[model samples]
Target: MKVAMVASHYPLPSHREEFVARVHQVADAFRRTPGCLTADCWLSADGDAVVSTVHWESEAARDASLATVMTAGLDIGYDERESRPREILHLVAR
Candidate 1:
């Protein structure tokens, strides 16, 4: 079944643009990955959060990509609050 992985991150105002750039890079990489249907990154209207969603052909595919895609060179920045963990969700169509 198709799966969508969604995650939202809160970054300090100073880090928002840089964080989004890194996320966009990762999303671009996923677009070339096998079994990745599509990937997208967006900023919250208030610019306090960055949200990303990557659609995969299956749950297994998403799991498989984690090993590589996550290592694609982006790191959590110091400006990101440690107190606030990312909110993530996995979804499937009803």
Candidate 2:
């Protein structure tokens, strides 16, 4: 199963460049984890928030990854919005 996490920051007072730097560093860890097939993240162009889509070997792997990501202190409404996990339908290759 794959997990798509959308973390919405509630309009923090911090500077844009500072927020992006922290978010980008944490996002990098997702790419280096074992069993992580795909990990990609992007900030909202308006500079409000960031979201990341991560693919794992199995549901267990997905769950573990999500836990780790949340622990890093990103501004995610974990309690407000439910976490979502979906099975991958296809993967295109070059």
Candidate 3:
């Protein structure tokens, strides 16, 4: 079954644009990875938050891709830019 991963990020006021750009880059990289169906990034209207949603072929595939990406350091630098820890949610099609 397909799985969707949704992540919400709240960047520091000074890092909003940089964070959004980095998120877009991460989404593009995920889109090119095997088993990734689609990836998208959205910026909040107030410009302080960003959200990313990625769809994968399966939960196993998502986990594998996440591990690979982490090992490769292909991330948005959330630890440095975010005001706090990001939130990640997993979902499946209804």
Compare the candidates by lDDT and give the number of the best one: 3
Ranked candidates (TM-score, high to low) = 3, 1, 2
Candidate 1: tens digits of C-alpha lDDT, residues 3-92: 898889887677777788878888888887788999999988887779989999988888877667877776734443422678989898
Q: Supply candidate 3's per-residue lDDT for 54.
A: 96
Candidate 2 lDDT tens digits, 1-93: 443444443235344455456556666776666667776656677755544555667666666776787686665433322223212333322
Q: State the lDDT of candidate 3 residue by residue for 1-94, as single tens digits.
A: 9999999899998988777888888888788778999999998787767999999999888988777676766655557668989899999977
TM-score attained by model 1:
0.85
Candidates ranked, most accurate by lDDT first: 3, 1, 2
Which stretches of candidate 3 lie above 4 Å from their native place?
A: 75-77
* TM-scores, each model vs. reference: 0.85, 0.53, 0.87
**Inter-residue clash pairs, candidate 1:** none
Supply the global lDDT for candidate 3: 0.84
Largest TM-score belongs to which candidate? 3
